[model samples]
Target: MDDRNIQYIIQEKFHTLSKSQQKVATFTLKNLQFVGVHSATNVGEKAGVSETTVIRFCYAIGLSGYAQLQREVTMFLFNEGNNSSLQNYLQSKQKLIENPRFYEKTMEKDASRILNISKNLHEEDFNRASLLLHTKKKIFIIGYGSSNLAAQWLYFTLNLLRPKVVLMKLETNEMIRSLQEIDEESVVIILSFHRYFKEPIQLASEIQDKKCEIIGITDSRIAPITKYSTITFVNEQQEMSTIDGMPALISFLNTLIVGMTAQDHDYYEKQRVKYDDFQNSFIADRWS
Candidate 1:
């Protein structure tokens, strides 16, 4: 397998790539296994671009042509922490069907990979992010499409540790009202991943104009949200099932929540005690 970092190329040069080229790049990156064995025309059709655009995208990233791109992708599949090609990997997994522990093994591998990736995260970045969340006057969390779940998780967890946290509504008018409340003292945490949505990007741009700090929780450096973020936590996601797998992202959020709590245990304890008091009061029918 070759050592080419195709992801870095697409991310670093994304701004320069034309709209069609960008589309092709996104499709290629997501379906590298297909690209390794398919023709430029097939890829172009799948990406809704022409074969010429696909070839241009390959050259735009410094590859000689489609053939070289395939070769590189094939190499990437083989070298992706496993010494097997894409085809071989699929074959091996298929052969495991009759095995008693196949499903368990699959689950274990996925979980292991998700956790292992977190190890690459820098402590300094976490510290900076924790401090920002801890000190920011207000924190607004937003996500769209499939990412909304992640945004909600962060909002709920962070609110438990502090106050003035809100999960922004997805409706345009409602979100705009929340946006109007933002200022330099606000910190916006945006969750975005592949098949990137447009509203979040627009929201980030608006947040940028407000001069507030943006914390981007996304899947890659290439994610559009990162452009406006003051700090970014990139947790690579996988299509482990019919839907996207977000164990890694959830884990990262847990880390941030714990880090923020550790930053000031007294505040967290007070908040917890207050929550308990409210629960007790409700139980006693003390409120009208």
Candidate 2:
């Protein structure tokens, strides 16, 4: 089997795919392990498409056949953790640094990914998401695994700007208790990326059940959470590595924060002043 990132291939070819093929693509991206193991007929049933359509989707993405598609999916899943070790990470960084133009290449990649955000994310959705964050009585953020850091950054920054911003803990019982407090006036921001977790998807679904607005920050348009999102920002990564996407995701969040602050400059300014005062008086520890 050729070495290609199945998820990237599917995403790149997604727009050109027929609607039925797109369904298969979405399902395949979301459920790679299932696709790797299941028959075309089973995948078809799960994706709500015909078995023939699933086979065609494989060809549409440049795979030779269903067998090659399965191999690609399996290999991608197996290699997901290949660079996860500290030693491997250090070696990768070392190799990059050995290149004379490493800095330029790295910056170029980051710039490209950040620029792609404007293409994948729509202005109307961005404006609506910003407005929702500013107006909602309560805001909750949920993310897991690799997404946790981004979630925490957003929660901390948002709390500085507004009141009642909750960073939902990962514990199921605690999450359920927190969910009880959400209502139509609440807005939930769910951050999920490739190798997506189930908890955030389920939480988004429940938030949808409560008729609350959801701001989904994800890498794919058909990510399960997007189905429940009131507004979604798809920050598709140019590479398979989650680390490569961090700069773009952070940039997107920074823009959202700027938008929220811009909505009421005076109010946010006052809030920041109060925040500084509170931090200086209560939170800071100084050694003189």
Candidate 3:
């Protein structure tokens, strides 16, 4: 509603709409370009609902009417450009499902998403985020649901590059206690995507109140976490689902890790060597 982000608006109001309207919403979200170009009657036919239901669906999602819906969809599609259109991405994904080269096609899709990060992510923000990771006194990484995997990976990798890197747990009491240790010098990296869990946003808000720097990695620029963040990296997922965003998120984290290490190559290289030595020594001590 705030940004004319039709997808976000539909998602927010999806559960409140009627079954027929929900169908139209789902169809419109998946086939944005088609909805933009076609009439309400044609869209309803494709969604397997009546034209009236389609118009109602538009209003249900807070649009003025069918015309406004079309305009919103058109603006969304135009802003996304031809390359990143949801319709084209969905069409390609459907084709891949029927193709014999399943593994290759899957990797190709992920590769495309990773490439998109370079285009979408701001260079200045990336550099500043890397610098924060390199110099911050303490670092905390948090992500809920599927995003936790990326958070854990970053915590593990970053822990080797620097000390005092904590992987924040999702438990309420634990998170509250962890807050006591966080200060302005601490940096919190949060990974949140579609179907975003509220815990991270809440935690980011708390961190913001403490004057700590928040680095937000999310699918949308308007994601709630962004409001509380000092730097944000938007990794828009091709699909509507949550898990599909992992590859790009991990790739972005990897690039961030590389950038952070590049800041003081000699120091981080020494840290990695020390970590490897400790691991080998621990293994020998346990085995012996």
Candidate 4:
């Protein structure tokens, strides 16, 4: 029990405490966000208290210490923000690595989401993306934060499948500047999820000028979607108990990659032959 997650603990038993303990609770309630990047001193300063008071505040809240408290607090906040069930499964797997129940529950939910998308998989969207994939419009996949890795993965993956696919994960303010290249019929795929991206949403809105279709691979069919989207694919990150886990999204994209690779045999064969040769020679030695 740590004060890092003081907000949750306080919420659980705020009214059952004494006056001094309540003071610390009030401070934490007011500025729980500050705890994310700040130390006890910084939080105390914002809470109108001294460093030692913050330490006592930690104990007062029933946390073992400040550090443990922070980890729990972070997890609580993260779980609260993310609603992806994929995260739920991955975390459960980590927690219950040796348990069969975790895998059983995880695969059930994972299969559900995956099968749902597969059942609802729109051929029209695939056609739209395929049409753009084979064409030339400087395809840009805009993702940031955790999705940056996804964007980069797509960038490389799509390169072997097609060509000239770029993953753009610029600063929030710099998104509009990147939209300069968006012209008539330009393909822009926006990838995002919890915590959502405001800049990409804005860019998608601003992309109305382009004749190109904007494909929104979003968590939902909501704002920050493309104007003339020929197809829309929403990758759902399944969360267990509000945790915005990423495995589902990753699995979805993995399917997308496999689908795209299967659709283009010439590209896949050439890339695979070259890759296997390189992998067996340069990389296989290390693995062996």
lDDT (tens digit, per residue) of candidate 4 on 167-245: 6656654555567766764688777655566767766667766666777776543323533355677654334322333
| Residue 256 of model 4, lDDT score | 66
TM-score of each: 0.69, 0.82, 0.70, 0.55
Q: So what's the TM-score on candidate 4?
A: 0.55
Ranking of all predicted structures according to lDDT, beginning with the best and ending with the worst: 2, 3, 1, 4
Q: Which stretches of candidate 4 lie over 4 Å from their true place?
A: 1-101, 172-178, 223-228, 236-245, 274-288
Q: Candidate 3, after superposition: displacement of residue 180 in Å?
A: 0.7
| Model 4 lDDT, full chain set | 0.63
Off by over 4 Å in 3: 1-94
Residue 85 error, candidate 3, Å: 20
lDDT by residue (123-232, candidate 3, tens digit) is 89999998999999999998888788898899988877788999999777888778988998999999887657888888887788888889989876556777888998
Model 2 residue runs over 4 Å out of place are: 1-4, 30-56, 62-71, 81-95, 277-288
lDDT scores in order? 0.78, 0.84, 0.82, 0.63
Give the clashing residue pairs of candidate 1, or none.
Answer: none
The sequence of per-residue lDDT tens digits that candidate 2 reaches over residues 20-135 is 99999988887889998999999999999999999999889898999999988888788775656344335546767888989986788688988878676777888888888888
Better of 1 and 3 by TM-score: 3
- lDDT tens digits by residue: candidate 1, 36-122: 898999999999999999999989988899998887777656656464234444654675677898899777756775776677677
Candidate 2 local Cα displacement, residue 84, angstroms: 3.4
